[model samples]
Target: VSVQLYANYAIGKDVQAMKAVVGEEALSSEDLLYLEFLDKFERKFVAQGAYD
Candidate 1:
């Protein structure tokens, strides 16, 4: 659980850093899709109590 949380937190920080460096206008379709995938995966993970 701690590992997953840390990984998510790290990914979030990386995304924020990327946005800060490149700006939101620079985000590509692939980046949007990747973010969507992460959202769905997180939702499913929570719904299924995967961390537990």
Candidate 2:
């Protein structure tokens, strides 16, 4: 799920879903590994558009 979400966000697929998930997890979690994964996802990928 995490990887899929990350990929989707990075590639500009399901952005609303990704944003919702990120918001939800970011607001309501203290789990270190989970948070780390979110952080990694945020930093590890960038979505590029047709115009750059």
For every model shown, the clashing-pair count is 0, 0
Q: What is the C-alpha lDDT profile of model 1 across 1-52, one tens digit per residue?
A: 8788657655655665687889867987766555565566567655586456
Clashing pairs for model 2 are: none
TM-scores of all candidate predictions against the true structure? 0.47, 0.32
Candidate 2 yields a Cα-based lDDT of: 0.50
User: Candidate 2: where is the Cα deviation over 4 Å?
Assistant: 1-30, 46-52
What is the model-wide C-alpha lDDT for candidate 1? 0.66
Alpha-carbon runs more than 4 Å astray in model 1: 1-17, 50-52
Best by TM-score: 1
Model 1 TM-score, 2 decimals = 0.47
Minimum summed lDDT over a 10-residue window in model 1 is located at: 30-39
